[model samples]
Target: MSQILKGGCYCGGTTYTIAIPDKLPQVVGTPHKVPTSILDHCGKCRKTSGSLFQAWIVVPKPWITITYKYKEGSGGKLVEFQSSAHGTRSFCGACGTNLFYDSSKKKAMVEDMDGVVYLVNVTIGSLDEESLTHVELVKPKLHVWWDHGIGWIKEAFTTAGQGFGGLAKYPTGDVRQSPEELI
Candidate 1:
């Protein structure tokens, strides 16, 4: 059975629904192969979210529907930013809530043999807290851009016994200093 998940922006300006596949793929060791969710620590994600890491839910683009409203009287609308030549990032223009990341080029390149469009990534933090009871189903399977990750992030995950074995390390050196060490 497919599951319907609801989410919106911080100011309730943008709302979305996502249909999750019943038979989600298992968390695999390969970063590109994992089919559920992933945590990103790349410079762009960190700068966009102002967080050390951002959790994203990966699903087929066709599974999502989004609507935007400016205020009580204003009609629905959406604002999108072309983050890269082939990638677009959407957000609530009114309140600046980072909402989505779409890579049509990536999807096109990965279309199935049957020519079906593939997946897109949405910020997991945008979902309504109450509607996230089944969040475990979308728990991040791996951490990407580990070389750009903050030291405390690594330490926290390590302390929890969920070390960085499944991490995707970029060539950039680890630049983050742990707060504890600084204190």
Candidate 2:
């Protein structure tokens, strides 16, 4: 059988399925290992998710398929917001469930691949609970915008051993510095 991951919005108005690539690593004792998962604590992500940090699973756009269960007399469509100049965030129009984040430009290049590949960062929270049998695989590998994160959240990431050096730092003075300034 083909390996597939299924998920949907809170109200079930939006659903999706992802075809697991064979190239993805497999944990010996776990069902899967998401090699491209990361945690973002950027101001924009915090405001958008209303959380201290947002866990995201990055995958090629071609691997995912989305479906919308529109309400009676409502058009079946997912709402999208240009979160930044280079990225767009999508959500369920009916229930306002945040679903996806797509970059306007292809950010990475695959040497073996023929053409550019666009990546879509999906919120792990939107995934179906049952579909995440190997929940360990979804653990954030790295923390981005760590400097912008609250002191407690940054400490949590450090305790978890997922904090990236340089970017992750204890809050000292002003915490509103842009990520570019930190770099």
Best-matching candidate per lDDT: 2
Q: Of the candidates shown, which would achieve the greatest TM-score relative to the real structure?
A: 2
Tens-place lDDT per residue, model 1, 41-121, is: 888888888888988987767778887666665443557888778888887777788888888764532223235455688
lDDT of each: 0.73, 0.74
lDDT of 1 at 61: 77
Residue-level lDDT of model 2, residues 1-183, one tens digit each, is: 446778888888889998765567433333434346788989988889988788888766777999877788654468899988998998888778888989878344433334566768899899888767756456667777888889976775567555554464535777787666765
Ten-residue segment with the worst summed lDDT in candidate 1? Answer: 26-35
Instruction: Identify the runs in model 2 with alpha carbons over 4 angstroms from their true place.
Output: 25-35, 111-113, 160-183
Query: For candidate 2, what is the TM-score?
Result: 0.75
- Misplaced by over 4 Å in model 1 are 25-35, 72-76, 108-114, 160-183
lDDT score, candidate 1, position 36: 64
The per-residue C-alpha lDDT of model 2 at residue 14 equals 85
Model 1's number of clashes is: 0
